[model samples]
Target: MVELLNAPNIDQYAWGAINGCEAASLLEGLHCLGKLTNVNYGEFLKQMPIDEGGNPNYGFGGSPYKNQAGKFEAIFVKPLADWAANYTTYEDLSDSGVEPIYQSVEAGNPVVTYVTVHFEKPEIETYPFGDVAINNHAVLVDGVNATQVHLSDPIDGKYYLDKSKFEKIYLSRNMALALLK
Candidate 1:
């Protein structure tokens, strides 16, 4: 088993309602890599880009303060990666599967990965642009073992998820961002 100690556990609710998971996960990853310290959540939230039209590929879709349906209410790896580049090096590992994730963890890097709320079954909603997981949530993968994956979740803090179950939800989108030192 390998676990990176001192990974930050940030609650999205502390920053916003149901929309700050991405930002919170990013914060956790950056902090885990020692790239950021003494951050102001308000200032960090203000700097993140928001695409009100529900295009998560470019920026966060919908308001970070609202939880209404059909607003997409999520952000993907691209925008997060671009924004994180300002602080530290990052790699967009979308569709790269679980191997790289373990590798990143093994290298003492935390990965910000997309998964459903509480790591539950994904609820996908298809839009004209693309499919969006309504329960989409982001968490920092900070540890790995033969049977379990540990996470610093934005909403639930830190916990261990079954490796098989984690991989199932993880591969659904296979979206991940590796924060490198």
Candidate 2:
């Protein structure tokens, strides 16, 4: 038996347009962990790791302007995990298979993963990594009951999606994931 849950109160638009969905989803996961363990996540998110770019930085952190590219999580996720270690440890689940993802979610932390900006709609472009479609949004995998995956979309809110659909978008974006333990 495996059961995991996260807070559904992630406000992806908390910082107006400065913070991206990825940052917001990370915030949601951290806040949920804080609630589960009684810690101060509010103070932490205000100073979380961020990409250094144009006005998008907006002091805290912001997404890159259109037409430009940057590895969003590479700029923060690992570092956030390192910083959060003061409270509890975390695991890097990037490029992992579905079973590991299931294990990660079963462990309590919702998997902070990516999906396409439009879910099924993506504009193919050649990035520094390779010629592939881009994942322009961030979401949390709250739980997995068999093949059904429950997720919280920072933009669309909470819902359960088909595993195949989730995998399609996730794998296409390189299966980027991080877990807090």
Candidate 3:
């Protein structure tokens, strides 16, 4: 078992928003990487591109505070990676599977991964560009053990998800982002 100690536990709602889990998780990863010390979520949110037109690949879609039915409500690995690049090196670990994810935790790197809210069963919504998980949410993976993955969830804070269950939701899109120092 390996864990990245002192991983930031940020609540998505603490910053006056119900969304922005992606940015929250990214901030946790950045803190884990020692890339950020004094954190201001409002400033960070301002730096992120808000793509109200539903382009997950380019930037965040929809309102970070509320979910719109037709717009893509989350940001994917690409934009997160692009944003993190300004602070430190990053790995676009999309479709890379679970082993590398665990390895990252072992190496003391926190990974921002896309999983369903509360780790529930995924509900995919089809977009004109492609199918997207309607319940899509992001969390920072800060630890891994023999049978569990430790996460700093932006919505629920720190918790453990069974490896099998985490894998199930994770494999739905197989998307992960990590910051490297």
Q: Which stretches of candidate 2 lie over 4 Å from their true place?
A: 1-4, 35-45, 53-87, 127-135
- Angstrom error of the Cα, residue 153, model 2: value is 1.2
Query: For model 1, how many clashes?
Result: 0
Judge candidate 1 against the unseen true structure and give its global Cα lDDT, from 0 to 1: 0.84
* lDDT (C-alpha) at residue 158 in model 2: 82
lDDT of 1 by residue, 1-181 (tens): 6855558788778776668788888988887777667785556777788877778888888877886666677788999999999999988888889999999888988899999998788898787578778899999999998999889998898989899999999998799999987
Q: After superposing candidate 1, which stretches have Cα over 4 Å from the reference?
A: 68-70
lDDT, candidate 1, residue 159? Answer: 89
- TM-score for each candidate, following the candidate numbering: 0.94, 0.71, 0.94
| lDDT (CA) per prediction | 0.84, 0.59, 0.84
Q: How accurate is candidate 2 locally (lDDT)?
A: 0.59
What stretches of model 3 exceed 4 Å from their correct place? none
Model 3: pairs clashing at backbone N, Cα or C within 3 Å: none
Which tens-of-lDDT digit does each residue in 1-181 have in candidate 3?
6744558787879888777889988988888777676866777887887776878888898878777877786788888888888898878788999998988788877889999998898887678779888888999999899999999998898988899999998998799987675
What lDDT is reached at residue 114 by model 1?
93
